[model samples]
Target: MSIDSQKGAGLPAQGTPPVVPPSAPHSAVEKQVARSYNSAVANETLEDYSLRYAPKSFRRWSEYTVATTALGGIAYLADFAIGASIAISHGFENALASVLVAALVIFLTGIPISYYSARYNIDMDLLTRAAGFGYLGSTLTSIVYASFTFIFFALEGSIMAQAFHLGFGLPLWIGYAVASLIVIPIVIFGMTAMAKLQVWTQPVWLTLMFAPFVFVAIKDPHSYAAFTHWSGGTDVKGGSTFSAVGFGAGMGVALSLIAQIGEQVDYLRFMPDKTAANAKKWWTAVLAAGPGWVVLGAFKQIGGAFLAFLIVASAGTVVADEPIEQFRHGLGVYITAGTLGVAVFFVVLSQIKINVVNAYSGSLSWSNFFSRLLHYHPGRVVWIFFNIGIALTLMEANVFSFLNTVLGFYSNVAIAWIGAIVADLVINKPLGLSPSIVEFKRAHLYNFNPVGFVSMLIGSAVSIVAFEWGFGHGTFGTYAQAFSPFIALALAFVLSPVFAVLTKGKYYIAREDTLPEPLTVDGQLSGVSMECGVCTDHFERPDMAYCPFHSSAICSLCCSLDKACHDMCKKGGASSGPVDLTLTRASS
Candidate 1:
């Protein structure tokens, strides 16, 4: 298909159109202005289309490459810490069962979320906008996702700081600053730099990560048996056996990592469009790197538990949960000389690998959140510092000391948000309660959609109550308090479909896709390029949407940033009042 050579018919020529005298009222073109960004934001390489759809032209990575990068980001050591913490609080059996259960839930829910993101080449924020949350409704989800990034960033940064303190005599505060500041230069380049960094470092990182585990198995095979018997010297309520309360509380801590799938999808959004020729490789990549991250993560958590068991027998519970201390003892099994140095190296490498993703994905999340709320986007690069600064503050506050408390409390809200989106993608779409396709462009979405927005709010509210206060009393309250994450998940999942039916799915699309060119041609996204009426820049067909104010096609970013239009296109459907969305309960 040919690129549209002309600007919008409604827009005049490139130079200022000759109209009335200079003192006259501003021309129509002047009234059609939008907040613009610098070249840094406009350049796709640096920005990576943070707040807009990633076009087909830019998705050039091979399936293996994309999958490898996505999986590489999962090389964090937090799973070990989380597992160790859970095991210290609850015994081996409960921790094991909880981690496994949480892994299964995350894997199952992540399948639909990752598939839709890879298929549509949009980030989780954009996907949320169309899946069930409407345009503005997704801003809340963007904040949720952004919080996940910085929270993990602080956690990972803390781990790295611990390495600095152990390997060198650096103060913990100085180390925190060092760890937080280093990733800025790397993350500023976005995917172009990350793709290379993740790929090049994968082999060495993998070898370092597994070396201690393999050596431990070889040197002391009986340690595995001993771990199942050791209990971190705690009275573990059930005493190494599984208890319902222990299992539920442990699951809540483990499920906090559900938001990790969002970071994975942040990379999966770059996957090349699948075709018959690449079908095998594409599916393999998606399944392996998308939801398949949990497989490796589960092992890491279990491995962390074993390592903690080895150390806590002598090091005490406080030292056992720290990744640096856990690894030092585990790797000391064979590397008798300079064990601290070796372990510190591994910890630092692991932290860098994961924190880069944390910072990068956080920038995207912040960019998405602020753009809609403030209608001002300096650039994706600017937000990298904002995300890291928050993380550094949390790190200085010693966030890692209370890791389980933070993660466990956070799981309720995170699970609810992810659960609502998963339901829309997997259940509602299949049952015809929601649209089959993802319509993410701003021009085509309502301000809010109850199908996802209300479901998530109710789920979060109920689960948070369960988490804080429990149900009524007795055994039921104990279970409810412990399993609040699951409560959020179940409520959101069921209610998404219920709300979709009640709302009649009208809010999913605010206006029909009346653009001249079809989104897809011959079963694939059309490669046709169109000029944005506002920005006057060209974007692929998927990123372009018709603007009634412009009377021509405009790019999604321009539509998102335009404060002047006030959604004149959507307003036409409703005469005097707000758009008649059941989500808002407003009518003309």
Candidate 2:
């Protein structure tokens, strides 16, 4: 008998191979199957590279190099701008407390996310899919993650445009276009190109960034004390008493950065396999640069806060609110030669490095979202433009004025997703509530899981209510904002274990015995290879798979996007329980 007919012996098949069944009950699985097929067809170099499984051969870089390259993207000047803006608006005391609280939270949350990505070599999309979101549920979070990348891309690109307008007298429109287009070619090559670009730019960027601060410290020692006492815009009520609500709101805005761990993990996935010799460096790099990004970010924010205070004291209220204006005034204290030109040049250069990263990460996010939802991936290159196009539109519409509103609104959604994922990774995995290793492939995952989905929905709903209710409005409207991220994290942590107990971990892995290949000392799958049915290319054991619908072994990428099969081959036999029931009826 044909392999297809043999596999379908229990069920009646009118025509065609049993593996690729002619008909089946319609469900979300049908859509998933179609998407998987389409993604397989587009598995060219330009489209859907390394989707289903990460081949060991492709992971060639040293852990340190990968970590450094990833961390370099975080070297954004906008931290300073954000810090300065918050301080000038909220006063020194509030901004300082907010910065401290936000930094601590971001750093702590980043630890588990970074470790898993590095250990498993999977991006956040894959990570979320396995964590608890299930196959289709993760797709929803992918859209949310993509939104974070592009929104930041637009914000960073806008900053670049402003710098261009200041430095070269270019129109903001032209500057925005220039900023968006420049990153496309670099991103086309993906991680390879980004590493070189970030490495080369790091030194010059660091030098320019630190020179002004050093000069300020050496020349005007007395300015430091003035920074602490100066109140730029915040109104003090009843003797400088701390307001929990005001502090919470400011912290929420600053803590919106929690999603940035996704970008960091994208790079960490490239880290070399851990070994006795490389383990020290591997752990060091991961910790130092992984969640450690907040260290630098916090410092920059504080510096921005200090600079804003200095500007208020010197240039008065109008320019104090603008970070660029504040920086220009401060840098002038040091540079006697062409001070205006030097300051503008430094600002422009700093913004370009950061905006490029924003655009690049955004493209990856968009690519993941559309490829899964629409069942077609033109290429990563195509999405780069698609992402940029959105950002460009936002810029033209003058999004800068609405920055706080947009970020505040976005934080609720972003935090919910991040917190849910973190809860699963840190709390669930360790406590035996979820699978230890990430199970990202569609063939190996359920369509939906209640753990992350329920947690995020509940957390976001509550936080939104608190925000709208104005609980912290008495201190500063921003105080009510802090509730979202914490609520999401806390609820997800509590709910994941409960969900695991109820579901009994059946959804964590489809069939554990299916993964029979032996792993190397460092967890690398070994000693087997199979050819993809769609691409007809051979892959290592980890990248190869058997599909019951097609009645053949295929590569992981092919299985991921195959839309035709309807998942006829699952654990033990056919796709669904009804099919097996039908077979028993026929036999009787």
Candidate 3:
């Protein structure tokens, strides 16, 4: 909790050249190799504090605005498609049970994560780093979270492309390009542009999304009654009866979206600090925009199921799950004159709203992943193109063709990763087994923490085995394949605490915080700013850590990029002796 002034004894004064130690090579130690980011990365407006803590100084939006913007990003049609697909495979009875179960699980798990990210002002990557996965250890979860963004991005883009094909007579290839390219201009500006875009279009999107359903109720009242008895297709076993295996299969596909909370927290990180005066509004906003997203998402899935049931006989089951097709037939029930145009417009808007968020969150995760590995960061804007390009490639390859298979297989890994993090945040921290406060800086965290990282690995490995080969090959295999996601979640949750106790929580923090300034003031992250000795840029207090090697305060970005330091400040490098790796109880 106190600064180690003795470590800077032999170190030269700030802004002065230090005496080169004879024990090390002189060439590499002569100059401070600090990282310099471009204007896009340096400025909070363009970068939105990507790859670092979202300081209080930059989190200026009101709770209502932040909540709306976060919820706006969830305006995707994929839920409808996912719901329709699950129903098609598992019949109405099983699909209904599965969807509700998945939604409940997602909502409960999302609560702790959302609260932490909003309170701490850090993205999912930083949260993971401190929540059991260490600095380098979080790199694994970063890739897992990044994959979620792009896979969904491609799926949403493919849906948008279908709209283009339906309305403009564009070929699927050209439509794919259009869908991928449209979000670039908007996403280039980061949260500033995205907030405006989402807020302005939300009303219109909502109107179009629900208009068809309202009209169908008035025009075809009997359709709703008939849909209740729709026992999937002839392919489904046992007609409309529910089956345990079928429910589990549906849950696996629905649970693939466990990582969607990462996207929610990507925005939740910007939530203004909650004060007593705004406590009511703060909790409401966080819950609604965070876990509350699944409420609407579940409804959309059911709505998609209803719409697909209406048009399956006419359009065939193959295209029933496509969002563009679902909306086309739904809107056609009332707006006969320009149904295609309206449906295409709605699809394009929904895709753009959600894809920008997908692209934005992807850039953040990729930035975190590459920064730790390469020790270099050009800018966050650069990664937007990289994320979109990958999604575009997937679209070109027609990734939408194998949606169920891809999502089902992916759910195992996603659930395991998220489950481990949730266990750390909810169980380990509260039980005084791990650090209560999220310590995300590279200076304090170990390279790897077995508590969450190994638990996630074990959970993912076992669940993937269950999903692919299924325990053995008989009835066990069938049940295992159907319930692999549940297995992954349970193992990760149980193992996180077990590993924390086994490791004695020593791996959680490499060294105690040595910054001179307090991390917070009056129960809130301090707005006091400090200048980075290496980067020569001013950053907020939470982002700055004392660097014994440089004999000055350094920003986290500069600390992360300083290759020559070798973390001497924490490890007792050239100037300081190795610090004790003791387990300390962090403040609640």
Clashes of 2: 10
Q: Regarding lDDT, does 1 or 2 come out ahead?
A: 1
lDDT of 1 by residue, 1-588 (tens): 211321121111233221112222433664356436698898889999898778887988999899999998998999999999988888798889999999999999899988988988889899999889999999999889989999999999999999999889899999999999988888888889889999999999888888888888999988787778655444322236778988999999999999999999999999998889999998999989999999999999988888888777678888788999988988889888999988998899898889999999999999888888877889999999999999999999999999988998899999999999999988887787877767887777789999999999999999999998898788889889999999999999999999988877777866556566667866777777776666767788788776656545678888888786677667634211122122211111
**Tens digit of lDDT per residue, candidate 2, span 233-289?**
532222333556556666666776778888888778778866688889999988877
Tell how far residue 304 is off in model 3, in angstroms.
Answer: 1.0
Off by over 4 Å in 3: 1-35, 234-239, 572-588
Question: Count of backbone clashes for each model?
Answer: 0, 10, 2
User: How far off is residue 69 in model 2, in Å?
Assistant: 0.7
Give the whole-model CA lDDT for all candidates, comma-separated: 0.84, 0.67, 0.84
lDDT of 1: 0.84
| Residue 95, model 2, lDDT | 78
> Arrange candidates by TM-score, highest first: which order?
3, 1, 2
What does candidate 3's lDDT look like per residue over 463-578, in tens digits?
Answer: 99999999898998999989999999999999999998887677776665555566677778877777676676777877877666665566788778768767665553222222
For candidate 1, the 10 contiguous residues with the lowest summed lDDT are 579-588
- RMSD, one per candidate, in order: 7.7, 7.8, 6.0
Task: Choose 1 or 2, whichever is better by TM-score.
Answer: 1
TM-scores, all models, native as reference: 0.92, 0.85, 0.92
**lDDT, residue 295, model 1:** 97
